[model samples]
Target: MKFYKKITEKSKSNSLVVLVSEDTDSINFSNDSVNLLFSESLSNEDLSSLGKITVLHTPDSLYKNFNFLRIICIGVGSLEEIDSNKIRRAAGSFGRYFLDSKLSNLSFFVDSIKSKDTDLITESFFEGFFLGNYIFDKYKSKKSEKKDVFFEVVSSEISNIQDIVNKSYEKSEAEKFARDLVNEPANVLTPTELSNIANNKTDKSISCKILSKEECAKLGMNAFLGVSQGSIEEPKLIHLSYKPLKNENSYWYIGKAITFDSGGLSLKPSGSMFSMKGDMGGSAAVIAAINAIANLKLKVNIDVLCLATENMPSGSAQRPSDVVRAMNGTYIEVENTDAEGRLTLADAITYAKGFDPKFIIDIATLTGAASIGLGKGNISAFSNNKDFMDKVKLAGDITGDFVWQLPLDSTSKKQNNSTVADIKNTGGRLAGTITAAHFINHFVEEVPWVHLDIAANSMTSSNDGWHNRGATGIPTRLLIELAYIFEK
Candidate 1:
């Protein structure tokens, strides 16, 4: 989807998208027809919700002077409280509402939009609109008839237009890439298949290296390998790097790639295991974000590591109370085979520490306690440094990927104490999310770090324009913005 820019107060359009608020008395437009259309829309539309839209067919007799098939007025609630998020949400509504029709293009009226930063607001609008318009019908026999919709945005306030253009394209395409990967079934995207996909991403702009199971074992990645021993699929330790001409900073990203988690010997109930194919949501997030970062050509050095494997129960699967030593020489007592993602992530983080990055950020769908604690549409954040976490929170706020920090005090660390090994994998039921973070923190060493537990927000129940029924591909935008913040 491309957004062609036209800086004008008025234009002849077939289908137009306009912003509306409850207190919308008038918009100071150079064209009187726009003002009249706004007034007409306010009279008929209800401003009850942020993403609500009122589609009105203007009478041709009264509006023969201007060319328009219909006017779409999306609710933004109040102008005083308007922000980028509201704009994105309202834009999402616009994107999702046009599913039945087929069209080449639409126009958005951003000339009169009230915003603190025109670039930020315009970028947010693009993000919301494109994301909301997304649908995962790859497996459907009959796909959607709607062609890829392009937009012509009219805005006098949009300066530095090329930056918005680049970011908008990169961000949306990156998200779509991640969503498509997550939507792929486990049978199709096994560990080797995922490694091939990662390998294919390499070019002059980026570099990718895949380590075989033998290579991993040579480095004493026993805990990481233990989780995949039951499955016949060969585990892949993928390392992707993006190095610019001048690197201002360096960071590492880790993702858990359990393509199909059957919970091993600790089997999940059939009902709970239905969507286990999305267990690699973290891998998608990390991989997608790095892809965007590299494509945008930001002046930063970054490394992305994904430990790809499957956790299937078999006669050779790791059993209860089994002890496995991590690459960091820390022994882990596998109390429950279901807690397998953290096992893979632990060695990945330890391995990442070898490169001596200035900071490390890992994202994963690592815990159900995250969803139970914060519900859906929110990310659970944990970090050892407040400043780093604050920057991540700012990125989340900028991107509408809401991140809520959880407690990781010393008390949470005590839950993982083990009688036989250095620590146990499962830390009981209480504070499960925090304990999981604490367990991963054990391998992060002294680096300034933040862990994003995206279990709650990675999958959605409804197929809104912004989210599909499965694999929401969250924190991709958030992580991209985090790299941008680091650049500044």
Candidate 2:
């Protein structure tokens, strides 16, 4: 997909057309382009009723006289409702249309919206369209191939906004990289393969370091390595850093990268294990968000940490009574090997503490309790610091990530009382998510920290507004926004 600021009328002869209902400063539809109307033919009342889109397609044989065959009218729900997200949805709707119709090329005209500043909206649509086309196709023979996509901005003066347009595309590219990594089968994307992806992609702006099993043992990451011992694939503790030349305050983000969660000795049924490939989604989100910040050259210092491993059952797997030392030197009694995300997060959080960052935010598909609590609607946030959590909430609000802060210092903390070791892995059935967070909280100690239990929101079993099924990539934009907040 390529995005250009201004496409001349000559460019329209060979392409399918997309037109906006109205004309604006930065986008102007050529006469040859399809006219996207708000209503049946683009009336004021029709625009109000058309909440999302109105599309048309012609027979393949009549491709001449302008292949203006396919016309998609996107509804802004009146001029007042037009925003970046709506524009993004407009893009997604376009992608879905192309997939359904098997169309090859699309030329979009950005002149419809009333906003004079069409630059950001145009760019955002392209980004959203490209991202919405994402599918985990590694195992499928009927994989969808990339089609030629063109976004043509109709204004001559807004060409300088190409930077934002290009940045959005770059962000999408990094997101796709993370998506691909998350979608790969567990056999192919072992801890070793994860480290290789980091090594191959790092540059001066982003520096990556990988610690193998032996190195992890040397660093006292026993709790993390204990879970990895059951698998043939070794565990990797990954640290990826991005620093700007003028950064003032640095922040670190930790991702729990459980490549595959098999419930260890307490094995999961075939249904649960099938989608376990996405267990690494938290790791993917952090890396993808950091990759976006680096690509945009945001003036901030950010470190991304991923504890990559697979949780399986074997003779070598840790038992329920086993106690292992963490990187922070805390002893953890393994009550259930299936409760492994917090163990890996403990090591990653301990490692991140080395940098003495201003703040730490850790993301993970930590527990099913989160789903039980939120019901796949919103993310649960637990924070030790109120001000920092407020800042994070503001960021989420701005980016539309939508997080709800749940109490961490609830009765769940008392429920984690372990008589044998420092702390127990699982705390009964009630408030399981909060108790798991308390378990990880032991490692975060004095730092201003926020933990996002995204188990419910990170991936969906069915299609729901704005987000379809599979990895939601829930909080990437929120993380990016948080980085910006800390930079200031």
Candidate 3:
């Protein structure tokens, strides 16, 4: 998709999109031809319902009078409820309309909207349009060919529209990159491949380092290594750093990079293993967020850690009741091999503490209990610090990736107690998400930490809101927005 700014009345396109509010009783267009077309359509049909789409097909004789082939009007609720999200959804609707109609070019007129911040409205539109157009058909033999879309956002009074467009473009592309990584099959995206992807990011401010299995063993990261013992592919501990020329404080973001999880010795049923390729969704988000932050040139320093590995079942796999030592010298008793994400995160968070960051935030598809608790919409967040969690909640709100904070109290911490090791990996069935957070908290020590169990929000079954059908890239924008907020 290509984006353009300041589309004029003389602009020629295959299709034109206009947003109509629910409160708008009549249709208005600056172009005389468009006004006449809409006026005729309004007399015939009502086009004021929210999210209602009305298409005006040009008559054969009037093709030359009107520059476009079709005119699409999207109902955008009332003026009072107009916000960036609504504009984003409207843009997404336009993207779908373009695909369904096989139209290559579209002129999106935004000058008619009444909003306090036109820049945000424009940015949200581009972001949603690009994201909604995303499709993962790499393996399809006869894939549907889509023409390159020419997207024009027409706004008269918005200042620096080009800058807003560029920013939104970069951010949406970053998210698409993350989605692509998650959509890849496990046969293609291994631990080493994931590490290579991080290393290939050629940003001047960002530096990446991948620690081999030998190096992790020497550093006493047995917990992370234990999860990789079953897989034939070698595990990699990927560390990426982004340092600004001038920085005040640094933060750490760790992601559980399980490329494919077969549940190790404690295998998952066949029904539950289909979407295991997306276990690395958190890692994808972290890598993509850092890339966007570097591209945006945010002045805050960041350390990104990804524990990349595959949990498979084999002769060498870690068995139930196995005790593994983490980098911080804490022994974790593994009661269920399926609870492997927290095991890798235990060591990753331990390593993150070495940086002495202001706050450490770790993301993972850690528990199904989180899915049961929040469904597929909200992220279940567990944090050791209230102020830090509040900051994260605010960022989530701003980015439209909503988060709900769950308790991480001592009652949940005691559930991970074991007779032999310091703590057990699985803390029974009750409060599983909180117990998993507690298990990671033992390794974080005094560093303020936030854990996001995104098992439900990582992927979806259908296209809704601003997300596509699969690999929602949940919280990628939230992480970037949080970094900017923390920099302030």
What TM-score, computed on C-alpha atoms, does each candidate reach? 0.93, 0.87, 0.94
The clash number for model 1 is 2
Q: Which residue pairs collide in model 2, if any?
A: 38-42, 52-75, 54-73
The residue-by-residue lDDT of candidate 2 on 1-488, one tens digit each, is 44454444444423434435343212223433322321335543343232355555543454344445555555545445566666676666555655656566666655455464476566667666666666676787887776664444444445555575666677666666666777788889888888888777777789888888899888888888988989988889889988885545568888889999998997888888888888888888888888888877788889899989999999998787799888887888888889999989988888888888889999998888888888775788999999999988987765556688888765778887789988878887888988988988888998999999888777766644345557667777678768778767
lDDT of 3: 0.83
| lDDT of model 2, residue 174 | 67
The RMSD of every model to the true structure, in order and in angstroms, is: 2.5, 3.8, 2.2
lDDT tens digits, residue span 196-299, model 3: 99999747789988999999999899999999999999999999999884544578988889999999999999889999999999999999999999999888
Give stretches of model 1 more than 4 Å off: 1-13, 27-38, 44-49, 58-67, 146-148, 245-249
Q: In model 2, which regions exceed 4 Å deviation? A: 1-9, 12-40, 43-52, 55-71, 115-124, 156-160, 246-249
Residues 212-243, candidate 1, lDDT per residue (tens digit)?
99999999999989999999999999999888
Give the lDDT of residue 25 in candidate 1.
72
Q: Which residue ranges in model 3 land beyond 4 Å of their true spot?
A: 1-12, 25-29, 58-66, 247-249
Better of 1 and 2 by TM-score: 1
| Deviation of model 3 at 486, angstroms | 2.2
